[model samples]
Target: MFRFAVLLLALLFAAPAATQSLQAQYEAFLEGTIWPQAKLAGVSRKTFDGAMGAKRLNTDIPGLVTPGAKEPPRRMRQAEFSAPAKYFNERNIGYITATGRSLARKYASTLASIEKTYGVPARILLAIWGRESGFGRVDIPHDAFQVLGTKAFMSTRPELFRRELINALVIVQLGHASPSAMRSSWAGAMGQPQFLPSSYLQYAVDFDGNGHPDIWNSVPDTLASIAAYLKASGWVPGRDWGFEVTVPASVSCALEGPDRGKRISDWAKLGIRRVSGKPFPEHEARAEGFLLMPAGRHGPAFIATPNFYVIKEYNESDLYALFVGHAGDRIQWGDSRFSAGWDRTDSMLRSDIAKMQRALEGKGYDVGGADGLPGFKTRRSIGDWQEKNGRTPTCWPSNALISAIR
Candidate 1:
């Protein structure tokens, strides 16, 4: 009993000592590593000290790699890659669309001026705004210094976060925003548009003309900054993002990717038609359009334009761009759902998908690194494998496909 009591007491004392040691290392890192980089980035010593002095390591943030640990950080828990339907939940979409429409009217003149200057549509800006932070209604509760500093000190992607930490310091030095006023998401995305500190420096705009870009409070600044980012990302003026279309069985689902673009007129020749029963605009006929099948053959497909890929620059996900575009459509037009429904499919673990991707890779197929998410490359590889095996191409992962691949 005496030995057990002494051992427990030792552990209790040792825990605090270990924590203090880590804290000391973190302070050293900030002074030796981060300070030099921030100095090189033109951040003043006062600004750097003011922003980072009291910051401590935030262990609660996701995907953190503990310093001096043997094993890597555990993969952050994510929602199951199930039906794509859940992504387009009616309640969430309805709320964003309804709120976006009201804001569109409220900022009509300001949006028009932004569109004239940036050449991105008002609806698109409003949709991205509504999606990003609920049009600045959502609380961004993390201090920029704490989140960035912790990630830079020790995280899965330390180098990337280190660069951003310096950028955050520069933002403070340039009088763009003070450290106290700079709130961010746990992932370090800041303001209404969820831009990183680097993106803020590169793309954020002072549309409200307040002598500085205040993305946190100024509505005009937030919207115009989104527009400016999209514009810089090669948003083509006078072109729609995409159209929901009916892809016939004759056309291969593997034909879906930004690189496989063809003139809209040529896709129409292959029996693709808009689900809305409207003709492809004559002006767009000559422009390039890529096939987009987010769910392979199991859900609605789209004829995406270059602008669709441009939207992906803000947040690199097919579903994210689709949600922004679809919500924008609802805000401008009316609340109508996708013409085709998402077919219910088997739920599989990401590990299962990764296993199947490895099998494909063993067979000389590029499944895009087997990261578990079915990107365009994975989807097309599935389609090609199905075709090779004398099966109809679904282009999506399934239990049967996983079994058959191996």
Candidate 2:
């Protein structure tokens, strides 16, 4: 009897059927969520089918990070950030810019009409379009359900994906798009506007009055829908996003967090002069904002507004926001210079950044150590050290960063 019981238990343990593999579970979830979303979004049935057939999760995309990977021997650490730009060279930027220009021209009438209808600036809308899909240059990699479903299974961001999946389903039910036609990034953002399904539900517009918010293929619809998002995000019609400014030598860039926000009048008093060599003259140049020095003293400086935060809603990275703002400026004026000064040298590698983060943490700095990359807190610590040592306060880590490891 004991031998029979042992054999039965061993058989049960070997099969382990109750816990499904991650891939199988994800596919099951995707099928259930995608179809309903497709119908509601009004994606043509054919478009839906094409996109669905082409869909697959991006399994090899790492967490979009590389913190603490061991450094390669005989390498300059700064190559990390700079290398990407090197690969995405001038030709790439030119192609990207031309694609944007073409899209802008294609939707010229709609953009003008939307600009008139919504007080959001035309260039800002175009900039968003340019960056998101590279004016539709980047391929839509995965269908909405599969991407979100995979992320939901594979990440700590399960709740976000779960909610997004529901929104995708809602889109199909509402006739805004179809399940198969809802193509987007692996993170689940969709359309030329790169809107999440929820954002599309709230902000997408049928600007040509075609009765469908066709952001996927309709140039007018996509451009106008972007305008609608900005307007709803509280874009202040004609106001500048912010201005490049030169700070007094005595001022500390470390003091430039969102917490230090003050009115434009307050900024003028602080000797924050514009790159234009004049005081800001528009949009209540007195509106409150915080200073931004992206690479500390080495990069351009700007006094940006709460509305700038709204654009960050479109994409979260400071680099992204700065690029968009600068691109907007470029559309208005060609390759205008940044005022904060740039380090032009490459970036520290992931392992180096992890080492730096660990060093900072060892000194009671409270930086979450060696996770993979340095963030705002780590940069602020560098600034603090620079100010103490009477250095330039560039916030970038250097050989000097290794010393005084607290």
Candidates in order have lDDT scores of: 0.91, 0.67
lDDT of 2 by residue, 1-406 (tens): 9999999998887665533344455555445655455555554455544444444555664342222233233333433233323322445445555555666677777778888998776677777787788776678887677676556555556557766766776677567777768898867789889989888888888876777798787777888788778778777766777888887777777777666788887888888888888868855576787787656666667888776766877775566666677676666555554544455654555666667778777766644355534445566677777677776776656545654443
Give per-residue CA lDDT, model 1, range 122-229, as digits (tens): 999998998889999999999988999998888878889999999999999999998999999999999999999999999999998889999999999999999999
Error in Å for residue 133 of model 2? 0.8
Off by over 4 Å in 1: 68-80
- What lDDT is obtained when candidate 2 is compared to the true structure? 0.67
As a TM-score, model 1 comes out at 0.97
What are the clash counts of all predictions, listed in order?
A: 0, 28
Task: After the best TM-score superposition of candidate 2, give how far the Cα of residue 175 lies from its true spot, in angstroms.
Answer: 2.0
